[model samples]
Structure formats: C-alpha cells, structure tokens
Target: MCWEAGLSTEAGNSVDPRSNGLFGVYVHWPFCAAKCPYCDFNSHVHRGPFDEAGFVAAYAAELVHFAQKVPGRTVQSIFFGGGTPSLMDPRSVGAILEAIGRHWTIDARVEITLEANPTSVEADRFRGYRAAGVNRVSLGVQSLREGPLAELGRRHTVDEAVAAVRLAQSIFPRTSFDLIYARPRQTLDDWQDELTEALWMAQGHLSLYQLTIEMGTRYYDLFRAGKLQMPGEDLSADFYELTQELTQNAGLPAYEISNHARPGQESRHNLIYWRYGEYVGVGPGAHGRLLINNQRHATAAEKLPFDWQRKVLARGHGMVTDDVLTWEEEGDEMLVMGLRLREGIDPRRFQRISGRAISERQIAELKAIGFLETLPNGFLRVTDKGWPVLDAVVADLAA
Candidate 1:
C-alpha cells in the first residue's frame, strides 16, 4: 500500500520540526574496497568501474520520492552510513546533501554525519568531506592493535587508524570512532589496554561493540568449524563490566548499551532511531521508520547496489518492503530499542503506541529480582544488573 502524507491539518502534519519530535535522513552507500571476515552489513566489493554520477542522481531521485511521502518537517540529522562512506567522492556527497536541502527544511543545527573506515587515502579526504557539509564523522577504527586489525581483515594498520582519527578530529566538528572487543582471542588485559588508549584518542563519543558471531559471516563459518573461539559467558560478562567501569570513570558514560559519550555529545542521528522518531532511509539495503497518515510504516530497499540504483532510476524508489507496524509489533520494537538507552522508556508513550498498559505484575517481578527500576518521573528503565540479560527482560515484558 502506498503511504501518502498529504499536507493537511492532520495530527501528524506538524510544521515545527521539533513539534513532531525528531526527524532525520539516512543514506546508505553500498560499496566497499574490501569485505571484512566479521562484517555482516550490506556491503560488497564491486570490481571494475562505478558510475558515481549515475548513483548520485539516483540518490537524489530517491530523496525526492520520500519527500513527497513525508513533508513539512525539518531534518534534524542526516547520516551517510554504509560499506564505507569514506570511499565516496566528496562531490557526490555534496550533491546528495543539496538534494536533501532542496526537499526538506533542514534544521539550522542539523547534525550531518558520515561513517568512514580509517585508511591513509580516506584520511586525506577528511577535509573534502567536511567541505561537503558533513559536520560529524565516525571512523571504523575497529582496533588499535596490529594483530586484531589483521585478524579482523582490516586493511588499515594501527598507525594509519590513529592518523585517520587525528585527521578526522581536526576536520570534523564532532568525531567518534568504533572499537570491537570480545574478539576470538582478546583477553581482559588486552581489551583494557586497548580501550584505555581509545578513550584517550576519543574526543567526545565512542561506539564500543561486543563481537557477535552472526550467521553467514566468515567468522561464523570458522566458529562452526571450531577454528574461531569466542569468550565464554563468564569472560564475556567480565569484559563488559570492565568496559562500563573504565568508560564511566573516564567521564564518557553509557547512554546506550553499545555507545558511550560525553553529555550533549550523543549521536543525534542514532537517537532518532533509538527514541523511535521518524526518518527516511535511501539507497541499497537501508531500513526506515516513517509516519505515513499518522501510522508508522517500516521500509527497506533493494539489497544489491546496481539493482537498487536501477530500480530508483526506473520507478523513483528502490523500496522492496513497506509494512505498517501493528500495535503489538510497535510495542515490542519500542521495548527493544528504548530499553537499550540509559534514560529508559516512558510507559505513557508505550501505552500510547501499543494501546495497552505494561503489566504491573511483570514490573514487580523484575523490580523484586533487581533487574528493573522505575524512575521518579515514572520512566521504566532496565537497571545495570538487568542490562546483561536485556533481551530476556524485554521478552518477559513483551510477553
């Protein structure tokens, strides 16, 4: 079904961008120089030539297509995420930004961000990207150690990663980099030393993720073959607890489970997702949540890069999935995303979305078990004790 948000005096048609809460845009660039063994993101190694101009035009058309569906809102954030957005030409990025500005009333303080992988060549382009209006940059500096970098199939060395981070910090007003701990052979002492160094390099924000073995990745194949060994339950928990302690003491607290940031430095684009706000996802394999006729519709695009570009050029969009979420699905999703945040979820908003009240019996059980708590302002949050088993808590509550 087509989701059309016409300009009418409807409840969702709020002109003030902040009036309707946060609105954002996500652009996915689907090419990468090389594929990592542990990566499961929709990325590909495209050989031969890439038509940057054609892809840029397709992106612009896709933006206009979504603009028609959802209008009269200010864009608070725009994120270029992907295989490796740093591989993109700066002019192409600027063109996409121009198209967004053309379609939406961009907020004066819009947080425009691009995700990059740390390489010497990509580092050289940092200034060019900043000039293209990308004010924030997140580097895929997965590790600071030489061994981890090679084991993870990263092309950049430790020195290169550091140089890239330093360059990105000097160029972008807001900069953050990622680190993956709990690797196949990573020890507690190893992670501690690496994360401490990371904390020193980090300016304001850091995306610290625990290594998970997802199906279909090379890591998973090796793990099944008994070649890749991961941390056990007790060791994994130790690593996590140590991470929380170190980052907390360093003054960058965990605002979200996998992300730590200084106060006021949280990624606004990511918050649009965790806070359940509306955004448009453009390009290959990008997923989005949008308000269509006051209902939340989940959308996704074609996965292959060339195929997505072809579809966008032919039909003005590449969306292959658009499902209007049911109340139960919305509630489950709210719990899944919102409970990851330290500030937690508002029960009132949950009620409004799901049209049902949270079970008081369930809440009491969780609270008694020291897994959950209610804030003085009536927000229900997962306590630190509950966080290690967050999925189970969310499942119990959703049930």
Candidate 2:
C-alpha cells in the first residue's frame, strides 16, 4: 500500500547507472479541467482548490528520492504528461524542472516537453512555460472540425485550437499537436480534408492516434449501449493505410506507428521510451523503467493525486511497484516498444536482454508473409504492410 517504498540496492550497487543507457524523467500532473469521454489516462477533475505550492514541494522531494536511488546518470529528456499538464501554474513547472537540474547532470541539449490541451487560457501560458525552461509543447488539438471536437468532449473550438497552435509555434522552439482519426462515422474524405489542414498547421511533428474505445470509459459505455458506432475493422485499416501514404508524401513520415514527424524532429522524450531507455516517473499513476543496480526494474506510482502527494511527503517517493524485470520480460518489452518505431528493434540488444536468439523459424515465417523486413544493419523492422497488424507481428516474434 505504501507506493513510495524504496528498493534496496544491495545487489544493484555494483552496477553503473550511466552504463545502463538513455535516461529520461517523466512527471505526471494528474489534474485536468475536464475528463474526456474517450480518455482512460489517470486524470481527474478536482473541484476543490488545488495547493500548487504543496504539490511543487512534493514533486521536488520525489525527484530527490529517485536521485538517490540512481545517481550519476545524465538526464537526456524530461516529459510533463497529463492529465493535462497545462493545468499547472507555470511557476509549478519551473520549480519541478529546477529540482531535476539540481539532482542530475542534465544533458546540455536535453529535450524538455509539456503536454497541453488547446484552449485560449492555456494558450496564454505558452510563453510562461517556455520561460520555465520547457523548449517543446505537444498540443491536444484532437480535431479541426467542431462536430468531432464536441463529440470528443473537447472544450476548445476549431478556431481556438488553431489560435493555440499559432500561439505555441510563436512561443516555443518546437511544437506538435495531436489528432484522432477513425472516430464514429468519420468518413475517409472528411478525415482527408481535416488531415490536410492539420498538416498545414503542423510544425514538424504530429501525434495521430486512432480512436479506441477503452474499457471503463464513457465511450465504452456508449458503445455497449449501441449508441457509439466505431469505424469497421476494414474501414479503420483503410484509414491507417491512407494516413501512412499521405504523411509519407507530405515529408513527415511515420516514425512510430501513430506518431509522424520530419526527420530529426521526433519526440526525444517518447523515443527514450520506445527505444527501451530508462526513465523515472514521478507523480500519481506515473510509471518508470529504471536501472537499479544493473537490473532493469519496472516501477509504477499510486494513481490518485492526493494519495500520491501524501505518500511522497511522508515516505519521500511515490513508487507502488518496483519489481526487477526478468530477461524474458525485457526482451518482450523491447520487441513491443521498439518495433513500434520505423527503425525497429536491435536484435543484439534483445539477445543480450533475453539471453536467447530470436527464433529463425518465426522470422522466416513473418518475412515470407511480407509482414517484416530485415535492415542491412541487422535490425528487424515491420514493413508498411506489417504496421496495420503490428500487434500480431510483435506477438509472433516475442512468442
């Protein structure tokens, strides 16, 4: 029940944190102005007055707590993810970043990013965030159409979203926004026109996600009641194929399954994750993959905001789970995460982690079926044809 409990490093003490590879930090801000019908992220709408100053202190303490566990690692990226991190005061963000710098040797070119929802008021805070040392912003501009925007429970209008994007572009050195496709009754042509406009507004990166009805969300309830109709499987596949073709032609290729970006503009923070890099997750419902003593450990924090804050203040950290991962888990994780990237997984690293060779028989089956391709450098990647059924590919390989 004590999420902030620490793992003893008695066996891990001989391991060098730096040698463990890419390090990043993830900070979760659990408060949001409203919860969308489709979102399953650990975000809540708190009606009472939020204690920004207290939360800032708790975040700083949590950072120090993790710093002690894994010392001497240079942080290459920091991501402030939601429940709508934009809800936080700019000063709160600054305090947390300052705490990180004090704990670790921050890479000179460290990519600091914050996730924001496009609203006029949040737009006004873009400058404050940049001044707070955030160099990048990812906007939640889910749609450019008013109907879909409302259906998605977004408070911002099309014009407001555009204005926010423009404001972000002007204030930050790097910016990206998200779009959701394959919505209920979203026609191919409707998406095409919208995507075109989105590309025009995009700077160099875009997070394009297919709408999925997650269990326990309002969407799921509506879907079960037959009120929400999703795109059919075949239609969704067509949408995926069209998205790849269009984004590739536009010169912002699909760097990851759902994220498209111009070369060199990929989200470094997200890359740290897909590349199986180590990162510390702070705040409620945050999850982390870290090197404790040389073993890769999986960590997750308490999910509720007040509970996490209270635990951190009392116990110095908010980690609920800190289990060391088995080689098989690491290998499977690498395959699932890395194959999401266009560059694919490094077989040598997989072997090193899993302590076994990939089944040549499985590879041959996938290759023969035209679902996978082997790079000249020996990495195994999913072909464009393989992306639609990526889950199957990863499962077959990881099996």
Candidate 3:
C-alpha cells in the first residue's frame, strides 16, 4: 500500500519546526442516520448494534499519536465533522476534547466547531455538545423548501430545520447552516427567493453550495442515465450571480466560493484549509495536509470503520497513507486552494514554500488575459471573470 513520498516508522517522530504555524485538529465521525443520495463523503448509515465505546477509544488513540508528533504546538481550532458528529455521544466528544487539551497546547480562545444535522434527534444534543466544549455548530439544513429537501434526500423537514436553527442559536455562541441550490427544475427566481429567505434567518454566516453530481454518488448515476434534469448553464449562472448580490447586500460577503460571513466571523477551521496551514485529521476516511521538517505531506486514514479502529488499536494511529509532496505538486496545490479564497495567496509565501517564484511571464500573461489581479498586499487573486472559469485557469497555471 506504500506509494511515492511514503513515510515509514523508521522516519521517527521528528518534524521540522519550520512547518509550525496556526495548526488545528479535525475529528471525523463517519456515521449518519441515513445516507443522502447525493453525498459522496465517507459517511455511512447505521442502525442499532454499534460499538460506540470502541470507536471513541480508537479516536482518542489516534489523537494521542498525532499529538506526539506535533508537541508544543498551539491548537487554534478543533472541528468535529462527520457523517454526522452529532450522532456521537456528548461524553465522547468531551473526552476527545479533554484528550486534545492534555496532548497539545491550546489557545485560550480556541474555536471548537461541531457539525450537526437539523433533525431533532441531533438538535436535541446541541446543548450537551455546547456544554461539552463545542462553541460553534454548523447545521446541515441543506434546503428550506419541503420539495427541495425531499429531492435532496434529507431526513429533516422544513419545520425541523427551522427549529434546529433556533435551538442552535439558543445554545451555541456561533451558528451557521448549509443550503444547496441549482437543482433540477429550479429557476433563478426560485433560488433568489430561497436564498433571500435563508439570509433573513441567517445570524451571521452561511454556506451556500451548488448541487454538484459527484462520481460514485446516486445523483451521478441518475444524471448519467439522463434521469436527473438540473438547471441549464444560463440558469445556474444567474443563480450564482443572485447569490453574490444577495449575500453582499446582506453585508455577509463570500470569504470562499461556498461560504459567506460577516466581518471577522469566518469559520477559522475552514480558513486553515484555505490558507494552506497545517492540520491533523483523525478518523476513518479523514484527510490531512501537514508540513514537517520542511516537507509537505498528505495523510489519509483507513476508509473502513473496522480497519481504522483496528489499526489505531494496534499501532496507536489510524493513518494508512502519509506521503510527502513534490515541489511541483505543492505549487499546484497552492494555486488551487489559494484561488478558492477571496484574499488569494501571497506571492512571497508561495516562494518561501515552493523555493521558486510565480513566473513573471505567467503573471503578465494571466493579468493580460484578465484572469488575475495584483492586490495591494502583493497577492495574486482571481478576478470575478476568473471565478466561473477557475478550473481552466488552474489547469493552465499548473501546466
């Protein structure tokens, strides 16, 4: 199972101190009440007959293992993402948080976020999660319309979704919800009205994702069979424009393509990803990007629940893949992730990591083509015209 750039046990726990920065920890709980038809994330539906205790122990073991490698680093944030992290016992969540505190230095104002579904079953645990150290909750209320909800294969109703938001607002210091638009049979007008209504209820932040048919998902199967009829290109473009206008007018401009936030209210955990900072991902199917000893690496846990659990129990870690990145590969990733942020990437930072500068020739070419703009901060950012054609621009630059 080894690949190029793979690290072995003999490499030891030594890591390059130059890799240090604002590090965060991500814990994945890969179980849900039901699997949504469109979801390709490593999530599974579980009935009764599960071993929650064993899973928690395995998770703690994985955390301890990484903490050893990243000792003395301050954790700025911790995110509990999922299949549905709300399915986890609050006690387990508390224990994991305690373990993190014990293993690593944590900032006094560390942001801790937990992802929850809007279903009452999950919502009922919000207060407990808050008590257990979760300060922010991102609810998966993917749509407010009953028809759209059903179409998206969600388990919660509109009323339940609203109630969940209300409940979360009451419990957590910060709350946000997700909404997916650009579905089949949806028009720009419909999306405009829906997004408007959502903004009215949104306290400060929103995650507006366009419905994408990913490979291996049921949605993709239906789409390839010509059974899924989504909005046409023109309609989707209108929806995107409407989203920007509405959110901007609402004073919650987009910090990322799918995320909007008020001044100083962006999700810090997500910022770590967009800024290409280091993080440790623990859980089945979780992926992590780390910089150690001046080498950037990607880490992936075992995808299966039993296998991950067994690996952690045996080796005190669940990572099945830990591979370093080549210089070209790292530069390509920098371009892709950096362009996702509105702030863009600093050219100096890029040069520091990649050991080479963005070619002046390429910069002049991109600027002439109107795909990039030089910010006052000396960062190269994608222009509005470049956003819709981002894939093409990234491809060209990477090439």
Candidate 4:
C-alpha cells in the first residue's frame, strides 16, 4: 500500500498510481451567505453563531486522511471552492494548508485559488487570504447588471462586485470572476453590453457560464410553472457564439466550455480536473478522482456540512463513497472531462489508461459532420461547430 510519489502500479497491488504527473487538492467550503435560485451546489445558510473552529479541525483531519492515501506527492494546485471559501477565516485556510504541507511535498510553483463572493465583507479579507498563501482569487460576480444581480439571489450589488474585483486585482497575483448569461428576458444587446463591460474590467480570466436550470434548483420550479422564460435554443447558441467571439478578440479565449482566459492565466486547479489528473477533494459534497493502484477511483463526501464534520471527527475522513471505476467507466470519464477543453484529449493516452482505443469510424463520422477534428499533434478535439452539439457528438463517439 505504498502511495509514495503516487507512482502507478499494476492493479490491486496498491503500489501508488499517478504517473500522469499532475495532482491537486480541492477544498470545498460548504457555507454561503445566501443560496442563489439557479444554484444546486452543496451550500447552506446556517443562521446565528456556528462552530467554525470545529469545521476547520475537521478539514485538517480530512487532509491528513487523504495525505496518507497519496503520501509523498507534490501538490501542483489547490482550489478553495464554494459555498463561499472567502468566508473562511485566514487562519483556517492557513491551518489546512499547513496540514497539507506537513503530510506531502508541495510544489514550488503550486497554484492556490480561492473562490470568493464579491461582497464588501469578503473583499476585506482578500489581503488576509493572500497573506495566508492564496495567490489566485475568483470572485462570484454572477452578473454586471443591477437587475440580474438581484434576480440571481446575489446579495452583493453590481457596484459592490465591481469594487471587490478591483480590490482583488490590486491584492491577489491572479484574479478571475464569473458571470452568468442567457437569463430570463435577457437580449443579445443586453448581454453584449454587460460582457463588454466585463471584458473591459477583466484582467486575466473570466468564467462565463450559461444559465442552466438544474432539476432541484428554484429556477427549475419557476421554469416548469411557466414563470421563468429562458432564452430559446437559437438565442442560447447566439450567446455562446458571441461569447467566443468577444473573448477571443480580447485575447481571453475560451479554454474550457465555460471558462475563458488569457494565455497562461487559466485556472490550473480547474485544468487538473479537465485534464483528468489525480486529485483529492476535501469537504462536504465534493467529488474527486484518483489513480489508485492504476484504477480510477471516484470519491464523494457526505453532503451535509455538520454531518460531514461529525464523520471526519469520528473516523478521520468524511468520505461516504469510494467506488473503483472500471476501465470503460474511466475511459468515458476521461472523454467526458477532457473533451470540455479546447486542447482536447489524446487518443493514445486515453487508450493507455482505459485499455480501449477511441473508434476511428466514430471519429470519421464526427469529423465528416465537422464535429470533430484531429490536432496536428494527433489530439482529438471538438470543433467550434461541434461545440454547440457537444453532448450529442460525445454521445455518438462514446456509443
């Protein structure tokens, strides 16, 4: 059961596996000031005073748990994501980081990103986060318009978000912000104006996501009740096209489906995910994939915040599911995650990992329809034309 260096070995021997050479840590801070209507993330609002110290301790313990499983590895990236990572006290962040450092080798140039809500309150902690070793900060701006901000259940005003972004730019070495588009009654002109303003304000990275109505979210109920009028498919396609055009012109092209970034400014933490690299997810409701003894194992933690903490305190880890994936499952996941990137996936690498070759006939069919193309270096990627029907293209290829 040697996980030293996380080197890959043959199946069931447990002699460490991570030969692809990238590893990361995802820390989910499952607490938010308020949950948005369109949000389906594992976030909750705990009224009144809560035991923050208990949670921090639990996080540290969980890090230790993962560290044992993947010991002697160099962590390339660490991401602090929702409910609102910015809500954590700087000391809590430092404690978790310290725990990671104590158990594993940290990369000299590791990218540490913290996802923050662009509120005046959280913006004040930007300096503290930086001082505590956070180099990148992604603000959840959601929108640039006053109306959309309110409609999205965002507590921060447009002005506040802007100010926070400015402050973050001044404080953090790297800064990225998010904006949701194709909202109810939103027109192309409206989006053009807002995205233009965002582009003007953007320094390096922007996460422009289309509004998706997930099954359990409030927006889903509204949509089913005929109260929410989302943009039609044609309009949605226009939004995507315009997004690519504007961001490309700004030198911040879409690196992934929803994320646009200037060259070298992409979120390395996210890249680890899209590249299908090894990583451990700590905190409530976080999902992770690791190359354990050459088998890709998917892990998920308990969804409830306090319940996760209780499990961690009692058993040293809150993980509730750790399923070893079959070769076919691994292959499908690799394609599913890797194809989201503009750089695409390498068929040879996929074959090496999955014991299956990507179908040449399927590739030909997709290419004939202009949905797939082979890179000069032989990487298979989805094209701009294909991106619109990416799900269908992937399904056909996977099938």
- Write one digit per residue (lDDT tens) for candidate 4, span 1-399: 111233223222123443467788999999888889999999998888888888898989998888777766778888999899888898788778777777767776778899888773454577678777888989999999998899999999988998999999998889999999999989999999999999999999999999999999999999999999988999999999999999999999999999999999999999988888888999999888877666778999999999999999999999999999988888888898899999999898888777889989999999998999999999999999999888998788787
What TM-score against the true fold does each predicted structure earn? 0.95, 0.95, 0.94, 0.95
On residues 131-250, what C-alpha lDDT tens digit does candidate 2 reach at each position? 788889999999999999999999999999998888889888899999999999899999999999999889899999999999989999999999998899899999998898889888
**For candidate 3, what is the TM-score?**
0.94
Q: Which candidate is the best by lDDT?
A: 1
- Give residue 315's lDDT in candidate 3 (0 to 100): 93
lDDT of all predictions, in order shown?
0.88, 0.88, 0.83, 0.87
TM-score of 2: 0.95
User: Candidate 4 — what's its lDDT?
Assistant: 0.87
Candidate 2 error regions (>4 Å) = 1-20, 120-124
Instruction: Please give the range of 10 consecutive residues that has the lowest summed lDDT in model 1.
Output: 1-10
Encode model 3's per-residue lDDT on 272-378: one tens digit a residue. 88888788999999999877667887999998887899999999998989999987777788888888889988877777767787888877888898998899989
Clashes of each: 0, 2, 1, 3
Which window of ten consecutive residues has the lowest lDDT sum in model 3?
Answer: 2-11
